[model samples]
Target chain A: MTMQNKLAWPKKITVCEVGPRDGLQNEKVLLTVEQKIELIERSVQAGAKIIEIGSFVHPKAVPQMADTDEVVKKMKRVDGVEYRALVMNLRGLERAEAVGIKKAKLTVSASPTHSLKNLNKTPEEAVRGFAECAKYAAAHGIELSGAISTAFGCCFEGRVPLEQVISVVKCFKEIGVSELSLSDTTGMANPQQVYEYSVKVREQFTDIDWVLHFHNTRGMGLSNVMAGMLAGIERYDSCFAGLGGCPFAPGASGNIATEDLVHMLSEMGIDTGYDLAEGIAIGRRVREFIGHDTDSSVLRAGRCSDIVIEQ
Target chain B: MTMQNKLAWPKKITVCEVGPRDGLQNEKVLLTVEQKIELIERSVQAGAKIIEIGSFVHPKAVPQMADTDEVVKKMKRVDGVEYRALVMNLRGLERAEAVGIKKAKLTVSASPTHSLKNLNKTPEEAVRGFAECAKYAAAHGIELSGAISTAFGCCFEGRVPLEQVISVVKCFKEIGVSELSLSDTTGMANPQQVYEYSVKVREQFTDIDWVLHFHNTRGMGLSNVMAGMLAGIERYDSCFAGLGGCPFAPGASGNIATEDLVHMLSEMGIDTGYDLAEGIAIGRRVREFIGHDTDSSVLRAGRCSDIVIEQ
Candidate 1:
């Protein structure tokens, strides 16, 4: 009948914020190194314990993330917080290790066509490269998470078979990689496909932790995230204001908007340990800073209960 | 795999455009009679077989839809096309019948608080009113469908209990209402709740033709629709450019965008016989006519495959 009389809210869920790295890299405006650090700090103050600080790509390739090392070094390290960086190759991993990035992510595309086109490597070559990165992460005590992009449907090669995605996961599994993050690179995942793919991956390695990475290109990003949550995935990667999109995936917008995701989770009584209003406010500020409208809807409209529209 | 090599696409998904009544009523813009008819005509050309043409309510209450009669009279009645309107009371029904409307929808909020606040009628009173209208439709050979709003969760009263929703559905069943359209008036439904409610409702009444009407207020509208689809609901209510929201429900947004829904269904190889590019172009044109931005994401960003991003 009333809020108090209804179901109690859910306990906090772990929210991995990837805006600084994943979000900024896709933007046209190349934020300076100081601005990136400031953004990361703001997200941390807004209660993001896991902040993806930056990436180790060459400045010529991705100028937005050129100062990954500086951004990672300058971020105010809170006690028990995890600072991560995107590392594509062994060289990138070495750079991340040098910069004290304790958690690093290595990505490989499951579709060989995409893998070759995106990374200039065959699937096997990409897997071996990530495997080398995984070994480097292991020796350096850095938490390594292998991410398989284009696991669902690929833009170049539509409807990537389940077997291809599984093989990539198996490759990561064989490489002694402890963590896996499956990405719907093109936002081609529906609930049914997400459920089926997640189940198949879970069946292979029951003990490993798998996180879901989704882009809302088809508007199913959050739906796929909920599907992943339903499939028992507790950890997810989201960008503030939904800031992440691959430059390679055209018409692909940001990842699931962090504020909307948190709002939905909090409303469902899932404890995300994040302040929703603060997140929304930060999301808005980032939009202003970026000088363009972000993909997040809740940020513009506020929560369902906040605005009172009269007929 | 190219589109040619991929699975056969689904064509011919029936879209029931509800923008004229359900959409404009929630918006601040109060279009005149001519504008409403213009929108309906454009929607009809876009291949919407079932159009919720208008609502017969007090003009002072819903100024946006004040010209219900003028719009319905101007409609070009095509064979196999159904133009419908919302009827709140016997007077509203009479008004629709006077306008030669052959199909009508009677809505009752499932939550008592919402029902009282929205319609100023108790659940029982609303049921009695709808029952009379159902009989009138039967006698006149006009079609009648019962729409239960807030069937999932209510913004005014937090989470709607499952029992209350079931009770309302049972009441609709007792009234011999064979066409039921369940609405998430406030977009408070999750996949689990939708799955449970749709299954329960379908299992209870094996013979009723059910459709899902959802608001994207909480970003779960499309996800909830997918849940309903999985539960075997084929017909759905949508608006071009996602242009519908309830003024009563705060942050209540446009219906699930028609073009976006069609895009997903077509990509999934489900037959929703609709042209996506044409639908998107129409959505953009309508948005321009409305002199405002729409909530539909696909319109702003072209189809995912259309983008040529270097990987």
Candidate 2:
């Protein structure tokens, strides 16, 4: 392949803040609806054009996200910001619609074993089950995206096959999902794998909006983002203070910190449209609310542009 | 530039383990000489060809490294592995000679503010002071390398100018020091800066050995390594368990973890001749000895190849 097509780096990236949904859902400390709304509002103020506000999963299954409906209802929606919710099945879709969620993400695991454990369905069964929710979302005029969890690798299955991921993407395409996200749920992706896989996916699925979600479980999150960006992918999911982990995966860590990602991208001359200092402030506030320290480095070390004045 | 020349990733990399010196020096809990010796032995066993044994700094300034001479004396010597020590002046160089250190690194700060605070001398004075030690090292048949700390950016001075760094490198070259290393003293390096600066250095100083040392304080350590590697720089300084920090630079995290770097490189199809499993084991042991967790993700999340077998 020629250099022009092979090494295309995006000039601007769209960062989707997933702190309120993906971040808080896995935390042991449950935030009230008001707290969740505040986080979403803070993220919007920090230049997050898209925010995953909450998920419509079973309340008992994920009690931390139990206040999803109330949070969406009470949150002051900004004119330009898009608030999205995640849904696993038809019932979750119905719940999202009940809250008047304009956008919803229908997610399934790419690994059969993970799908069985996380969603109580096989990979095929999970995608089949999403049919009803996809239809419901289309009928209600709700913007819907499909997410393939364990798209990079699974804790139980080791490496998920590329063919398997492609098959799932084909299914999502057949179901009329125009936007698709690939998640590194267990943080098992290497930069080379990310680059190669992204190249293939971008080639095959030319029409769909592709998003990359990475966990910093193995410290490859931002590196993978860099690789994906070099492969011409422009959208990524991040959390403030890096607050998120896979509850089902024992050793899983949090998503890439939003501030950390923004810091690196901004330094590389890539416009993220996000204020890193504001993101760090929000991260500090989240740490206080959660009563724990976070995995963010920019929050601790300050931005590279920060000057140190001698006392 | 052609893609082949512009992106010439090394097929093999030389990893210089700096845990025994850099990792332990800044730590609060002091390990016994035996523990330090054991860590060094384990690193050599895990295929570390070059190990920075210790620094010959004043005991009063860094009490944690007071037993450096004893630890170096007690450490087992492997035939193929090269052990090195750091020296700041002729006194420290004499101390290394007393221990019969075959190789020594004479280090000076690139930033004047950091040099004044760290060495009690300006940057120019620091380089001038190393002249006597460099001459002595050469006469004694000791292989000497010059390291420029704060080469990337400094906690006190912010961004150290590229011209300033080039001047220091030129001074080292004039002083007959053939090998040199650049350090991100406060972890302020971004990928673009690393790539751009490395390219400039590699072009200007074509014959000298160049090594990169990074701190993960801002979470850009490994990413910087990747950038440097892509720039055709093969040598790196890493600490087991990601130990080591700048005592003078507040909020600075540890050096990039040895196992983490090896793991990523191995997965990227680059051979480092180090066993990552043994590296992780050593990291865990170091953490236990220090009575704290390390900054390594591989130690917590396991290697990417690890499979979880649920009970």
Candidate 3:
């Protein structure tokens, strides 16, 4: 049966796993570099196409991600897979380049308040510095992607201007960053805002590969993903076992759980190229390894196909 | 801006709250009749147009609902609000009528295994008994609605036949019940199945007022709601603080939280007629009263508009 809707639904989509970088960073239980490597390898076995292994941030700022250099060096890399790392600036990119990393994402925040609090630089200042990283990346033969935090709304500032978000995209465009991930830093995006912004950004930047990253801080993460897909987006970023939360947004949930997102998309007949049962097992394992309860509904309640007939 | 999607969206829709009945019955904390009344009155004051105040099930079956009769008599009834209650059969319907309840819903399980375990009858036998309740309601001047639990799938039995659910609806039609609630008791429904089934049922039962009830057990509750909306169905059933889990499904979550649903809809410009801030406060209060954490995201992260600027 053909499905008709106001929006075009893609047959398949890319789900980028970022549990090691975005998820583990927020948890108090620090994982060994070996465990982080295990998580990344298992994600690849579960059919992950793009994986964000860790970040090259200041060790003092994010202690959980201090071992990024080791993780990038030791983790098993697959030939067809795109392993990504979050880099703060040119210095971080240099660190990644030293480790022979192929793909690094440059980060900025659209909310000026968030930019000041998290990066100690305004959003403008942050993107302006991306130019240097862009030049270095072009010379070094390394691929670079761009991510904008608080692209939809901000925790410190009530609402972020759409124009501010657009300006970051414009900078990324001029600096020749073709891949962009617009993230809901504090999970403040609603489906409508997401749909509108997705449509607006894609309309103007027609050649870019857009990835939507959302935090389930307020339970609208998957719904925002739905909105993004309806707006013709085909790539998303998620965490295993629902493992990430914004440090600034206290009591908020993490990124949309990879297991739950795969479950939903698969049922909708949209392929994510991930084995769900394998993913569920990994989600449960991560929660157990973390020695705490996670926010994963799939791990708690098994997939729809798991049926038990009682006497 | 005009919104266009594959489905037609209603400018406003009714959000039927079942927290008082469906939510409280699953909780270990037994609230006094006075507290139940307070919850009901507060819901009415918070712009709830339709609410399931309590149930008429046997005390042995659901001890938490044993005080339902007392709740029905003691609660302050507001004008223009449709206060609803659950009933097992004619006997339960008689009890609701004695207290002058204007509306009562008779339920049957679409899953035969669920029917045998929960109601001690098959799905076919369950609906046959509803005929008596329908006759009694018509003669007594009370309105009757039909609800098919486990309509989508069952914890005991994996996938329920779409035809079986339709047969129950046909039985309701023959008995003159026009408003029906099709509930995913096990939260085993996917968005595609929900959309296809919703469209099919509406196509066949042209005059029926369809209300979609979903559980957040597997985290697809709101996504299923989106599917139904995309299928042109309006009314939805939700619980406050995301309370209520099926006893049969071990480790499952409860219904989709009312506050979260309202938050999503209001942001999309679809009016649910509820005040979000007040709803969030009530959700937090429910968790406090029950002395446990709930599944409400808005309570934990606040609304999109609730911003706190850090120094």
TM-score of each: 0.85, 0.94, 0.95
Best by lDDT: 3
In Å, residue A252's CA in model 3 sits off its true spot by 2.3
Recovered fraction of real interface contacts per model: 0.15, 0.51, 0.60
What is the descending DockQ order? 3, 2, 1
Best by TM-score: 3
TM-score of chain B of each: 0.90, 0.94, 0.94
For residue B18, model 1's alpha carbon misses the true position, in angstroms, by 1.3
Regions of model 1 farther than 4 Å from truth:
A1-14, A28-49, A78-80, A205-208, A245-252, A305-311, B1-14, B26-49, B58-74, B78-80, B117-119, B130-132, B170-175, B203-208, B246-252, B308-311
Q: Candidate 2 lDDT, tens digit per residue, B3-115?
A: 21123479999999999889988788988988998999999999899999888989998777788888877777989788999877789888888887889998888998778
Q: What's the distance in Å from true for residue B290, model 3?
A: 2.2
- The runs of at least 3 residues in candidate 2 whose Cα sits more than 4 Å from the true structure, single-residue gaps closed, are A1-8, A116-121, A248-252, B1-8, B117-122, B248-252
Give a tens-digit lDDT track for model 1, residues A1-311.
11112121224567889899888888888887777777788788878888888889887898888888887777678878888888778888898989788998888888898788766888767887776677778899999877888888777787778889878877777788778888887777766677667766776678778888888876777777766765667788899998876555455567999998888777666778888888998888788789987777687556755643333
lDDT of model 2 at position A151: 93
Q: Write the per-residue lDDT of candidate 3 for residues A226-267, one digit (tens) a residue.
A: 878888899999999998876655767899999999988886
What are the lDDT scores of the predictions, listed in order? 0.76, 0.85, 0.86
